[model samples]
Target chain A: MKQVVVHPERCVGCMQCQVACAVAHSEAKQLVPAQFESPRPRPRIHVGAGPYNEGFPNRCRHCDPAPCLLACLPGAITRVAETATVMINVDTCINCASCAMACPFGVIRYHEDRSAQAGKTVAVKCDNCLARQREDGIPACVEACLSAALTFETLDAAYKRQTDAVARSVSAVAAAEALAPGWALLNAHKKARLELLTSPAPSDEKRAAGNAREDTHVRHD
Target chain B: MQYVIIGNGIAGVNAAEAIRRMDPNGRIVMIGDEAFPPYCRPMISMVLEGSVPLAKLPIRQASFYDDCKIEPILGNRVTELDVDAGRVDVNGKHVAYDKLLIASGADPRPIRAEGLELGNIVYMRTEAHVRRMLDALDGGARRALVLGGGLVGFKAAYGLMCRGLAVTMLIRSGYPLSMQVDAFAGGMILDTLTAHGLDVRVDIAAEVFEGKDTVEAARLSDGSRLDCDLVVIGKGVLPALDFVPRDRIEVDLGLVVDPFLQTSAPNVFAAGDAAESIDVARQARWVNAIWPEAAAQGKVAGINMAGRTVPYERSLSRNVIRIFDLDVMTAGVVDPQVITGAEVITRFDPATRHYRQLVFQEDRLVGMTLVNAIEQGGVLMALIQNRIPVAGRRERLLAPGFNYRALA
Candidate 1:
């Protein structure tokens, strides 16, 4: 399943993606009419400015072991098995905010809309534009990215691109070494790069080992 | 290999699932005292409040046991555990096991007062208790008196109030939820309860019950008698370890288990409220009776029982509850007296009923309490669990826009 992946380096902080998300979620599905619609539509994504004028768009990652689904007392939240998209049933939700508190990303919002069940507030979060995906095969946020910062792709494709970028950087350095007139040094560097590229990627066991080391100071009873 | 599990609560069910994942063909037998299938115990209050139907209580469908190939023996109590013989006596039948797990859970503490054995007194622990309370309400029992100001007591009081019954709560502590929250948060809870027409009296106790056959009134420690038709005892619960022999296993407030959830007896394990494991924050062996910890411990125990070695990490104390429109959450060691060199930061707005307090030991966050605005609860718990150093970020910890991902 493909998801909208945000690239912080290319984000220009225009918030057009957010606006498009709100419009896509609205009853009218249009920008001008959605502003005056009853119970104003809320954008599922948020763009925040960071240090040194860097901006990033933050939304739900749709975690595999989603905490929001676990924390929901009434069992209103569910995950689509085929797409792995986390969603909430608004009609069954009691608006208790347990999911809001459980979400680590702070993307879930508790919003009050008069048009929804006579002014009852409910938790709202990104559903990855489920309706649009079924129709257009892409999320509204990724479709609206002006700088092409967001890409809708599968996990395998994303990781492959990242590895390819790393390989390109290593090859570029090797070519630069070859131009410096040191054949032996360049060959040694090429051999090392080949071994690095051929070796299997890091696994969760390595991550767990690092975690155990970091937790040495913790007093275990 | 055959695995025998006692109790059908969340912990036991989770253990069964974990065991099935590892050893697919193991003969599994589960015994539970309750007649019904496993349900979410924490939602008992919601069940009492009539917000949720009883049909939706089961955590899994009836086909789950069949799919998992588990033989369930419900509505039967285990009478004895013969550890030496590798069997448990249930209703005069000896059930043998290669490995045994005790997840019997806990039972509500009985109210000990004169005339306490009256007919109308209800102890909220199981589904039967909730049914009896609902029946009493149906039979036109109007007024109720709840003893204890803790979580169970308040939930019972609130449930009774929702059922159109006049409720009067008496607490022995200075405020409600003394063990979980600070005085400020407790005071706000008291205010909320009082505003909602609940007669919440703190720093008081019910000394005696006056009645002919059923409870008609309760005499207070302050020498005052209040008329009541029903008495609901929500004083909390104690670990149910009476079925185990004292000489066979080590027992503290609960059954003592090691980091691997193994008891003194060979091939025997315990989890849930019945097992006393390590408390990470206090560095002590104690029964932290909460749902999340119990489920995690059950998983760890099940994995180990299936020939895989896994250590059960100690869990910090945590709770999230909503009382009549107010949201409150607590995590880690909230008591000021527990930690040495503790620094406290607090923000309270009585008008909006929003309160936030963070407790720090040196530079690490040890505890936190949030009311109304609690989106930071998961982040706070992660910080406490990871022992993140918050040296100069104390203010950021309390900030409304605190980003938890930044810590990574």
Candidate 2:
């Protein structure tokens, strides 16, 4: 399936991706015209400050077992089997924000649309630009990224790119090892780092452990 | 292999899907007592409110059964389970199976009040119940007396109110949703419901239903009578396990199942509201009757039945409901009675109708209740599931801007 991969290091924090996303979802589908629309177009992607000063655009990961999909009472949010894109049907949404609350990533946003529900609000989230993709195009965010920070590619291609990068790094390390006999420890560390970077990210176990602690601390008032 | 699943609800249907994925050529037979195809039960209230039509009730499309290649025997009830014989009697006909799953779900606990036998006394359980209630409402039934202040009861009352009926909710306890939320949150919910023109009476019980052929009035335990044309009994549900013999398969409030959802009987398994699985919060065996848990349990049972070794992960009790335009959610060990030795950090903004309470035992979050503001619920549940220690981060949990990544 095609997914938008984020390159935070390459991001300049321009926020053009957010603007483009909003415009893409707007009725006019243009920057200047969308701003004058009845209900202001809301961006599905959010450009937020990241750790280490590299700003990243956070959006829906479209998790297989999406919590938003499970929490939706109106059955508005659904995953299309063909595209594997999690889409929300705004017509059926009750604007309950159940999906918003259930999203662990806090990517789903509530947009007040006067056109839809007489100024009533509804849940909105990234659909991976499914409409544009049908025309063999990428998401608006990817298209708008001036720094090439976002790229839409298949999962296999993404993994291959990462593996190729790691292979090149390992080869560079091997060249260095030929010159220095004391680079064994550095090679092991590099391999470990590559493994961590390449593998599918696991759910944060440490944070979960912190939240599940069953001890008491006397509060100092 | 012949895989027979009783009750084509979420659990049975998901199990069938999972079984097909595992064993390609397995013969899957899904039996349901309901005439309609498997539908989302939670949306029944929306249907009653006229927000969602009955046509949109089915969870999957009409071609889903055919695509899955599973035989569906709808409107046929399973009468007996012959564990030793490896077969079940469905409406008197015995159907053999290599493995069996009992996901018959649950039925509304019968109200034993005096006037329950009268007409217009309804229990919200099946599509038929919604149809009956709708029919009565269409026949100009205006006043509604809804007994039980729980989730089902509240939904019934709210739905009735939406249909232009005057709804009066009678709660046996001191507050509504006492099982899910605390007294404080329940009071807020009551206020919201009342603001929407609902008559909520707490610390009250129906002494008797009084009428000639139909319920005309409900006599309260507090010496008051409520005149009503319709009565909706949302008094909770019990596991529908009458088909299985108690001696053959161990049964408590529900059928007892192992971690793999395997019952005491060989080749027989159980899932959904019908099975008493482990409560992940309490680390004890109990039935968490929520839909997600049912789906998870069903998937686990299906995989194991298909010769795949996968243990069922115990699920925490979690529920999200919209009551009178307010969103209320509770998860994990939120019941105050059982959540002893836990420190509670609460933040309530009555002005905004946003209330958040986090329950922590030592440094770990064990339970949480969010009213109006519930965006952090999924994060909280993940923390509970992962057993994350939040030692000094209790305050962050109730914060509106709290992010799970920050904890990481």
What are the lDDT scores of the predictions, listed in order? Answer: 0.78, 0.79
| i-RMS of candidate 2 | 6.9
Report DockQ per prediction, comma-separated.
0.12, 0.18
Candidate 1 residue A109 C-alpha distance from true site, Å = 3.2
Misplaced by over 4 Å in model 1 are A8-14, A48-56, A91-96, A111-122, A147-149, A164-221, B405-408
Best candidate per lDDT, number?
A: 2
Each prediction's TM-score against the native?
Answer: 0.86, 0.85
lDDT of 2 by residue, B1-408 (tens): 899999888899889999999888989998999878778887788899987898878877788788899988888789998888999888778899999999999999887667688888899988889999998888789999998998899889889988989999988787788888877788888887888889988788887998898789999889988899999999899999888899889999999998889999999999999999777677778888877778778888999999988887657787887766678878887764585687777777645657777777767788888887565477677788678776444665664444443353
Off by over 4 Å in 2: A7-14, A48-56, A65-83, A92-102, A112-122, A145-149, A160-221
**What would the per-residue lDDT of candidate 1 be over residues B1-408, giving only the tens digit for each residue?**
999999988889889999999999999999999977777777777788887677767777777789889998888889999999999988889999999999999999876688888768888888888888887887778999999887889889988888888999989787788888988888888888888889988777788898888889999889999999888998988998778998989999988999899999999999999999877666678788877677777878899899998887656677887788788988877776887887888776555566778888877888888887775477677677667787433544554444542232
Give model 1's docking category.
incorrect
Judged by DockQ cut-offs, the docking class of candidate 2 is incorrect
Q: Please, what are the lDDT tens digits per residue for candidate 2 over residues A6-48?
A: 8655666689999999898888888998999878888888775
